[model samples]
Every structure is written in structure tokens, then in C-alpha cells.
Target: MIGGSGHVGARAARALRRLHPDLPIAIAGRDARRAAAVAAEVGGPTTATTADVGRGDLGLERGASFSAVVTLVKDEASNAVKRAQADGVPHIAFSDFVSEIGPLVAHHVARPTRAPILLLGHTLGGAATLAALHLAQDLRSVDAIAIGCVVDADDRGGPASQADFERNEQIGQAALVLQDGRWTWARGDAATRRFADAEGVEQVGHALPLMDVVSLAAATDALSIRVDMAARDASTRGAGHATDLVVEVSGRLDDGTAARLRYDIVDADSYARLSAYGAAIATERLLGLEGGPPVGPGLYHPESLIDPARAVARLEELGARVRRTRS
Candidate 1:
């Protein structure tokens, strides 16, 4: 993993160690000492390596033998992705890019070569989407799918994450899902929804367009996919800084049957920790399975490649709940 040293990266490294103790995991970061510290914490056969994501050459030998490479570094963003493509490495990108950033980074990574690239975006990106797919297994066609999230405001986030959010705010609002097969670019407050979870139901969410929607739209035949986010336990007006998430997805199955899926994640740590778990889950998926079709080069959601049932099982093991309602 290229960004194995940071908060989410480190957590992912630790999770990998627990899941695959014999795997040779390496944590990379700009700071050598910090990377070493994280490797130490993860223990097992894991080792720490120093690599600058900002620099083109990550110092890896050409033709290095490795099954997959994960880019968790936040600073270099697209640069690391390009370099990985140059090295002809199958890569898993960290979940940092939002739809407002445009397609520059994703496009660049996909433009280079046929190397498989998976861009991890949002905790709901892969696992949650997969859960939706699993729920839709009994159906034939689906008109739309809406996934909702309630994240704790107080969750710790890294500098890169903070920067990404700031950039989105500066860039204005993003696309919101509309009825039929339409999307509208609306202001942040223009879209809002009510969310209820283990904590309770509250009106929350903004017009934040997530890359997961983009990836899912590309991956599945679902005509329209929407994601709304809110805080679980508090009202939108007084939601203090706490790390929690409540997501609900509604759509029609292939047979024109209506269906809905709900998922909630309550993390005790800050935003960074929750994000870390998301990244870690992706890494585990990449390393754990085999014989799957190589996910092509481009930005991808977790659901695109991983089995929804498997993803949900892992999340539950990590303490996230998946809920479904029968109609």
C-alpha cells in the first residue's frame, strides 16, 4: 500500500494483518519514521517503507512481483495513480476524490493503459453498493437505487480529507439524482432527506454528489442512483460533531418490483477512522479473493468488483449493520 502510513492507511494495514497474517504488507508514507511506527503497530510480517507519492518514482524496482498495489496516499493523488499505471501495476485508489473535482484525475489514470484501477470512494461506495446488488439478486431490472448515509460530524479526518471537502465547498454543489434518468446540479442545501437509524430518524443530508454514484451508474444498468447523507441521532439543525452514518437505498428490481436497502455505520473515532475502515476493507478484498474478472482501468466503486454479501459480512465483522425492508 502506497499510503500505508496515514490514519486510514494505517488502520487498513492493521486490518489486513488480522485478516491475512502471512501476507507481506508494506506501509508507505512520506515520513519514514511514521511508516515504521504504523508497521510496528500492525506487527506480523508487515514492513514499513518510505515512498513519496508526490514524486514520480516510488523507488519500486521495475517488474517487481506483486499481486496488487493500493494507493492510499492523499497528497499526490493522481500522480501516484499515473505512476502506478506506468509500472503496469493493478492499483486500488484511496477514496478521496468527489464528483465536484471533475474527471481529470480519474481520466488520467484510465487514459494511460489497460491496467486495472479501482478508485475507492466513500464507505458506501463498494460495500453498500454491493449490498444493494445482493438485495436485487432476485429481481431482473431496476429503475433506480438510492443510498443514504448519516456520518458523525466529529469523526476525525486527515488533512487530505479536510482539503478535499474544502475544495468541494469552494467548487459549489454537485449533481443530485432526479426522477427518471436525469441529474441536476443544485446548491448544497437544495436537496435534503429524512434519515432514521438505530439512533433515530432525523432530517439531514445535502446535495453532495459522491463519486460512488458515478461509479455505480457506470457499473450497473440501474437507470438512476442517488445517495443522501445525514447524521443518525441528531436533527440537522443541532447535529453536533459525532461520527455516525445511516444510509437507505430504494429502487426497483429487474422485474419492476420495488425494493429498498438500508445500512448504518456508527464509528467511535473521527471521520479519518471511518474512512480508514473503508479503505482497509477495500485492501482486504483485493488481497483476499482470486479468479475474479480484472476490474478495468477507471474509477470504480467497491460494489463494482466485490460481492455485496462478502462486503457486508466484512463490515458487520467490523461493526456496521446492513438492513433491508420487505415490500
Candidate 2:
């Protein structure tokens, strides 16, 4: 995997190892030493390679043997896509957390790469997406879907997250959901929701411009989809900040039946731990050990990309409790 040296990538490498010990894992980054260190920590036959994904060529042999490739580097999504295409490997891109910035970057970066590219945005990329899919399983048709998250205050994020936040403030427009099959953009008060989880009954949540919900709606059969983020308190507010996330999806089934699904993640650990676990879960799924279809090309959210049951089970094993709330 490219970018295996960074926080997300390194943690993902370790998670993949634990989830599938027999799988061969390798990490590549611009900094050889850091990559080597991460590989060592992961143990097994992890190899460290010196390559810059942004610069292309990653230094891999033309006929190199590998099942798939995951890119966790921070930057334009298009760049990641291009590099993955060059390597002719299935690509999994890290979620940028915030929805406003991810799609903007992805719009510019998705082109160029012919390889199947999956654009991941936040843990919602996997968990939220899969949950939506799972919730829709019993239904025939769904009119609209909403994904909600209530994060803890202590979660910290990586540089990419920091950059995305900075850009969001500059843009001054929150990414809106795709409602009724249209892109709706708005900048105003986020929707508020009360969440009762392991943490407590917290009035925690806001309607943030999340790309995953919008993208999921656009890509899936759902006509309308919304994603919201709510935190426990002010201390947890800000970019790269950490908090527990509560995800909920409500919509009408294809047969005009009402369906709703709720899931939650409480991170007692530091913010770094949350980010690491999210990345690791995605990596493990891509490796074909933890869950879902064989790793392949295309942009995706956790819900659309992997099996919900398997994804939730993996998250629980990582210390995150996946619970369903009463509809």
C-alpha cells in the first residue's frame, strides 16, 4: 500500500496484519525510514519502499506481483487515482472526514486513474455506507436516507484533515446532501439530534456537508440522502477533533416501505486511535479477509463498498460498539 508510513496508513497496515495474518503487506512512502519503521511494527513480511505517489512511478517493477493497492497519502484525490492507475492496482483512498472538502478534492482527482478507485471520506466511508446498505437490505425501494454521526471531543485527525478544514473555512459553504436527486448546497445551522450511546444522552450532532452521504445517494438507488455530524460538546469541535459518531439512516424501501437503521462508534482512546482504527478497517476489508467483495477499483463509502454485518463486526472487534437504536 502506498502511504503506509503515515498515521492512517501505518495503523491500517497493522490492522490488516491482525485481521489477516497470512496476507503479505508492504508500505511505501517518501520517507523510507518511516516506512521501514511502520513495516517493522506490523511484523510479517512487510516491505518498505521509497516512493512518492504524487511524483508517480512509485518504483515498482512493471510485472510486480500484488493482489491490490491502497493509497492513504494526503492530497488531491485525483493524484491518488492517477498513481493507482499507473500501478494498475485496485485503489482505496482515505476519507478526509469532513464532507465539504472531500468531494471537491475528489472531483478534481477521480479522473486520470483507469484503475478502480474508491474515494473514502471519514469512517462513514466504510461503516456508514455499509450500514445504509444493510438497512436497505430488507427494503425494496428507498426514497431518502440520512446518515448521522455524534463524535467524541477528544478525537484528533491527521494533516489531510487539517488541510480540509482550512479549505472549508475559506470556501465558506458547507457541502449539502443530494436531496431528491439534486445537489443541494446550503450554509446555515446544522440539524441537531439527541444521541444516547455508551457515552450518555448527548444533544450531539450537526448537519455538516458530508460527501459520503451525498455520493451514496447519487450512486445508490436512494433518491435523497443526508449526512450529519454531532459532537458531545464544544471541546470536541474543530477539524481533526475527535468524538464518538452515531450513524442513522431512514428512508422508504423500493416498495414504499419505511426503514430506518442506526449505528454508533465511541472512541475512548485518543483521536488518533479513532482515525487509525477507521483506516485499518478499510485496509482489512480491501485485503479480502475481514469482509465484502474482492478488493477492486472504484470510489466508495463503507456502506456501499463492504458488507454491513462484517464491517460492524470488525469495528466492534477494534473496541467500537456497533449498536442499533429503536426506530
Instruction: Identify the candidate with maximal TM-score.
Output: 1
Total colliding residue pairs, candidate 1: 23
The residue-by-residue lDDT of candidate 2 on 129-226, one tens digit each, is 66666666656666666666655543335665566557766777465666667776645654443455444554645555554665566556777667
Model 2 misplaced stretches (Cα beyond 4 Å): 58-66, 77-79, 95-114, 139-144, 179-182, 190-200, 219-224, 233-243, 251-260, 270-305
Residue 116 accuracy (lDDT) in model 1: 60
* Residue 37's lDDT in candidate 1: 92
In TM-score terms, candidate 1 sits at: 0.80
What's the true lDDT of residue 54 in model 2? 58
lDDT of 1 by residue, 270-312 (tens): 4455566566667655554432644555545577567766766
- Candidate 2's C-alpha lDDT? 0.62
Error of 2 at 149 (Å): 2.7
Best by lDDT: 2
lDDT of candidates 1 onward, in order: 0.61, 0.62
